[model samples]
Target: MSDYFHNKRIVVTGGAGFLGAYILKGLQDRGCGHILVPRIEDYDLVRPADIERMYDDMQPDVVIHLAAVVGGIGANREHPGEFFYKNLMMGVQLIEQARLRGIEKFVAIGTICAYPKFTPVPFKEQDLWIGYPEETNAPYGLAKKMLLVQSQAYRQEYGFNSIFLLPVNLYGPGDNFSPASSHVIPALIKKCVDARDSGADHIECWGTGKASREFIYAADAAEGILLATERYNGPEPVNIGAGFEIAIKDLAEKIV
Candidate 1:
């Protein structure tokens, strides 16, 4: 509903990814025409030279750094090093590059997993440093959390207008449905649909289904990101969550 982004040259890394694709579509729908997307094949973000090449080519007004190695608890537990290395390199390289190029704005996407594992319900942004993250996701979460630190420091020393957004679990269409890579909602939807179609009496789920989570529809997350870009600019990271939490079992039942 806002035209603040009109004619802006926005470069969204990982534009082919699940969340990145939705953000790109939202920008297009809101009259943003000069949207530049660089997929992994186009540029390896972990490599500084590739990122430099992209900044030289695009020269965008804003850089939305959404590229990373993401997965559910299972995947994170299995690939800790890959999760840490890829995410850290991508965030560090991209933000530094954007700052060097004098980009007007840089939007870094953070995650709720950055909060401490024992963080109280309704996790606050200031609570990010209270304790360590959940063991399963510490590597991946900490990697992205570094962006928040970099953004703040850049703003302090370099006067760069970089902002970080922390979003909770996101789900919608265009999500990865593969069991190995998918998040809770899509994975459950796929499993439930398949099991129902196959006449299974019951399907088991992980973690007792009592662990609560907050999920935002992908479209809403995109809208929130754009809104933050236009109205909010500050050093501390802002949470873009739905403000409502649900038990995993309840979410699975809704899908069923």
Candidate 2:
């Protein structure tokens, strides 16, 4: 760890986002001197011209792409087209432009949702393409999965340096708790907290509580991303997690 990121001018596409916030802190902690976070309002990454403009303005030596149109199952079902199109366009265009600009490295953040619907317990990185993803969020997952394809392709063809990382369900402070699109952990916590504040005897939850998931603290996930950015340059994607899984029923009991 010779301060690989200390002097590099890094650009994080979604630097204002939940995970992006922690990534910014990680970079700062690493003594990075120049880190640019492109806000979507300022630079709409889905558009190719804006991506080029971002490159011209930031002049980054490295790029860590964390921007994505994400949501829980409900949101995914409601806006599959938007999720697929936006996430796909943003990543594809950004990576292409970054390559053309000759950025030293690119770090693409992917999702565990990209795993197959029936991936065996303790999913392995090699099982990514064993089958199609879970139907609920397949569009978003597949969209992000293309980044891996692009990363490997560009690496082999043009010698572009890029890496992909897959992080599992993320939960911690600042987690989204919106009823319309929050993930399991935050949604569960919110329900419990709201019930307690209102003095309700019980709260209702969806599903049979049979599902299982693995979550990484947002800060831990950020550190993993930064480490991969500094150290990993391989063709395969890496999984970032706590290396454990828990059942939803068990998790709910613990929260209660």
Candidate 3:
């Protein structure tokens, strides 16, 4: 890749998270130095004042907005309001502050859940607004999707350089594996591993196993984000994903 990222002062929100960790290392691999990763304890991005303080303190050349309140379907079901409010507030405040600071670039990471429930397989970027997202993930999805709106409006009104990325279900190392919070791949890995140890005949799975999803490995997703930041600049939202899909039942069977 190009050395455009060399020595740029960048801030990666949620830099300690599952995908964020890979993104951080990916940035490092791209020779990005002066990277500032704020811990939640030290910097509360949801607060406008703190966001202001961060820009004043770091004066980063770029901001990758990845911090979000997210979880599995169950967690989303239990905390829709929290998911909606926190993600909305965080993305809104951060992007606005980045604009105010005249930051050179802003990368906003969105979710696959932003797509409508019945979106055509191998979900495309243009289909994002065809209908409401699946009921279980609507709140979190809409909250992240709003970043695309924010990016467009900012570009139109102020020429702010911001890009929004929608990556499909992410898996691989560092992903959550707990039943309460894990996505499909990690959850299934845990289930299978534990079942093997426990000598179980079979494992119960969620749904009818009819639903299918596309997955982007964390490392590959990180690479895509880095490349987008370095090269892609446009108004249309982009989909970052592997061009393959899998049925949940088939995935589980393969896992076992």
Candidate 4:
């Protein structure tokens, strides 16, 4: 916890959410004095007017845009348009308003889903645009990817201080466990727990079990974001991950 965040007014858009909870704890641990977390009921960020209002009310020195429309593959498939539109609108409007407000810094959190469907074993930041994202989450991925473009463009044109970070799938305590929207780890955890409680022979997992993924504990990912916010300020996007991949079958077996 450097003095970098101390005495600076901060606004974390999704400070009440899963990852957002860890972020808030980190900020408080780092001694941030004033932190604002606008609830959805109070600020519907998808609307430009609400964004403007949030800026007026919070008057944040650093804006960490983390609020997003997110879910599992089933949700993505069922509501691609909703995911794309809300995420894009929230990010674009928030970044534009932050620039206009002349904030000290803006940190935009991106998704690993933005990586192309068949990225090399070790995902590299430079290879972000080489190909299309996996089909199930493409709309959500592309919407978030736009922030990287906007961050670079804003820095180049308006000299606005902003950074984008791509974090692999995050899993840790207090993660979303709902079957309807949970990611891989939590979904698996729930299934395993339920099977054990019921004394079932086995549990069923989604997909072919051949898909591989890398995940970062939510706390570690939060810490990385705070570090990047305090120190790093470059146009190129950064990757926050554990740097290892596990096949779904292997991951499930381990969890079991």
Candidate 5:
């Protein structure tokens, strides 16, 4: 590890989250100190006043905006308005506040779901605005997509240094395994483990198990984020992926 971020104050909004924790670990490994993590219980990102106070207190050199209301299809469907409002408000407030505070660099994490549902396979960064996102995840996805737009605008107008990254479905340890809000990988792992423990012959999954998806380990995604922070300094968003795709059924089989 280099001293690039040594003793530099960094603030990760969702430091306790799955992907956020991995990103935090990467920053720590690079010698970062004075890391401030404000949990939702302590500070809600949706509130402008709280965000303003965080900027005043932490004064982070780099702000990684990862705090948001995230979940799978069922959760999104159940709480569409909350997902949209919380995520949109948090992102807009955090990035705008960071710009006003004159932060050195800002890293915004986008999602693949931001692309249109019918977008071409092997989705490219350019395909982001091709059409509407999938109904189940449109609100959550678009909320994050707005940050990319803000990044470009800020860079061009105010000369703010901000980069956006779109990472594919992420998994690994420390992932949320609750069936109500968990993503596919961890949910499947829990299900398989339980089924095997019960000696069940088979387990049933949703959606005909035909949809294809790309998966990235949480650690790998963090590496990509930091690498982009160090080497990539463009306004265009970069897609961090595993470079391979798999069907849902195939992925479950491999997990089992």
Candidate 6:
């Protein structure tokens, strides 16, 4: 294991969350021993004052910002305003605070949901702004997309060592199994498991069975983030993906 992160004091904003667990393990595997995770309750990152205090308390050399208000389409629709406001505030405040503190590096994790609805089959970083995201998810998508803008601006103006990454839909164990907020994978798993136990014959799902999506295992996504944190320092965004897409219908069939 390379000792690139051996002694660097790294602060992962969402270091205790679903994806955060895998990322922490990945960092540990690479011999990164100095990781600080300040929970959201202790420091509500949406509030500027808390953001400032967290930065002051942590005094980190590197920050991998993964803290976000995210969930499946149902959650997004029910909490569009909350999602946009909280996500925008957290990312904006976190990046700005990291900048003011003169940190060594800032890594921002974006989502595939931010892409335009009709993006070409294999989405590319350059095609991010060609159009708006799907209506159901536009609010959440645009809110997170702002991070890419913020990261690029910071790098250009202050020459900050910040990089933004876009990861496709991620799923694996330790996922949020809650029906109200779980993403497609975990939500479907829960539904199928419950039905199987009750001896149900069929399941119900949303959408027209036309939308397609790509996925990256949670562990793989974590490794990709660590790799970007250590090896990549450019302003241009990079994608962490499995390089394969599946139609929603096909995915559901396989899951069931």
Model 2, 94-186: lDDT tens per residue? 999989988999999999999999998788899999999999999999999999999999999999999999999999888899988999999
Residue 221's lDDT within candidate 5 is 92
Give per-residue CA lDDT, model 5, range 120-142, as digits (tens).
77888888898999999999999
lDDT of 6 by residue, 15-119 (tens): 889999998998888888888998977999999999999989988999999998988888888999999999899998889988998999999998898999999
Kindly indicate the candidate among 2 and 4 with the higher lDDT.
Answer: 4
Indicate the TM-score of model 4.
0.98
The C-alpha local distance difference test score for the whole of candidate 1 amounts to: 0.89
Whole-model Cα lDDT per candidate?
0.89, 0.93, 0.91, 0.94, 0.89, 0.90
Task: Please provide TM-scores, in order, for all candidate models, with all chains considered together.
Answer: 0.97, 0.98, 0.98, 0.98, 0.96, 0.98
Clashing residue pairs in candidate 1 are none
TM-score of 5: 0.96
Q: Per-residue error at 161 for model 6, in Å?
A: 1.5
- Best candidate (score: TM-score): 4
Of 1 and 3, the candidate ahead on TM-score is 3
Tens-digit lDDT track of model 1 for 116-162: 99988887888899999999899999999999999999999999999
The lDDT of model 5 is 0.89
User: Residue 229 error for model 6, in Å?
Assistant: 0.4
> Which candidate, 1 or 2, would have the higher lDDT against the true structure?
2
Candidate 6 residue pairs that clash: none
Residue range 1-256, candidate 4, lDDT tens digits: 3698889999999999999999999999998889899999999999999999999998999998889999997899999999999999999999999999899999999999999999997799989999999999999999999999999999999999999999899999999999999999999999999998999979998779998999999999999999999999899999999998999999999999
